[model samples]
Target: MVKDEYTLVLVKPDGVKTRHIGEIITRIERKGYKIEALKMIQPTEELLRQHYADKVDKPFFPELLEYMTEGPIVGIVVSGTNVIKAIHNMAGATNPVEAEWGTIRGDYGREWPDGNLRNIVHTSDEPSSATKEIKIWFPEFEFTQG
Candidate 1:
């Protein structure tokens, strides 16, 4: 049997509104990960507040909250070998201008009013983060033994 790893993925508001969901998922699947769980939901202020607690004190917090809650997004839990790093590479840098071609952000991101890249997707930066984020986004969706 093939051993697999897992990662958390977020098809951000822009990606969802732009109708890039299928393409993004296809890219991940083509990279060899399996979509273990997927859902579309509008995040609440409380959820965003907690999810981005690390950024709460930043000057961009308010706007970030506004942007995140503006529309529905797809939350996904994907699993495969070395999936965490693979997914991060697929997501690219937070700033689209700095991202290379073929990455999700590089292809679909836009410059925000604040001059930062409001990239169209998010992936956990590491395995620990993936575990934490997955739980936050999918509390009721349990991971079973493969």
Candidate 2:
């Protein structure tokens, strides 16, 4: 039997600036996933640092941080069987150039002249990351036992 799985999806700053939030949500709903929770937040440096701890020390982290903080982002908790992997696939490749034409990033993302890749969304790569990330964006949320 298929079990309900949850994942975190962040429509990053670029996506918000470009006003694609509605379209993104429509796509997610079209996939038959339930949006359990959603909120728009202007992320703090502390919050981003916690969420991107693994990438904090990377060379381009500052650029990434700046891009993320440029505007408010929409955080969504989506639930469905295999939603984590499915959403990741829907988000497309990290680089829009490498993403498939129909995926979110491929359709709405682009590499800026500054060399930053403005991917439209961020989805948890796995269940553990989803749990960790969901807390970062939705601290008040009650987690499932699964």
Candidate 3:
């Protein structure tokens, strides 16, 4: 039997900077996804490092860190059938310029002349990623093992 899935969605610093939090949440609710928990966080370097452990060594990590820490980010725990993949598709491409028109990134994202890529949102790519990210962003929530 298929179990309902839970995933993490983050309105990145750019999303908050551009004031798209309400619209983003509205889209999630409009899709009939349950928002289990939500919080606004001023991300720290340590938390970001742990959240992005795989990318810490990448050349763009520093820039990413700067961008993420520039302002507050909204973390949302969403639950529904196949929500991980569904929300991922809803978030659109990593680059706003490449995203589809109906997706969140394409609608609210903006390009910076300084070449900083400020994609508006982040969603876990898969179940495992959701598990880990939810722990990072919503540590107080307990997971029920299936």
- Please give, for residues 18-124, the per-residue lDDT of candidate 3 as tens digits: 88999999999999999989999999999999899999999999999999999999999999989999999999999999999999998988689978899999999
Error of 1 at 129 (Å): 1.0
How high is the CA lDDT of each candidate model? 0.86, 0.94, 0.93
Pairs clashing in candidate 3? none
Better of 2 and 3 by lDDT: 2
Per-residue lDDT value at 110 in model 2: 90
- Candidate 2 residue lDDT tens string, 1-146: 87888899999999999999999999999999999999999988999999999999999999989988999999999999999999999999999989999999999999889987689899999989999999889989887745
Model 3: lDDT to the true structure? 0.93
Q: Model 3 Cα displacement at 61 (Å)?
A: 0.5
Model 3, runs deviating above 4 Å? none
Cα lDDT tens digits, model 1, 1-146, are 65676788999898999999999999998877899999998999888876787999999898888888879999999998888888899988888889888999888887867654468998998877888888888998787766
- Scored against the true structure, residue 118 in model 1 reaches a CA lDDT of 68
**TM-score against native, each model:** 0.92, 0.97, 0.97
Clash counts for the predictions, in order: 1, 0, 0
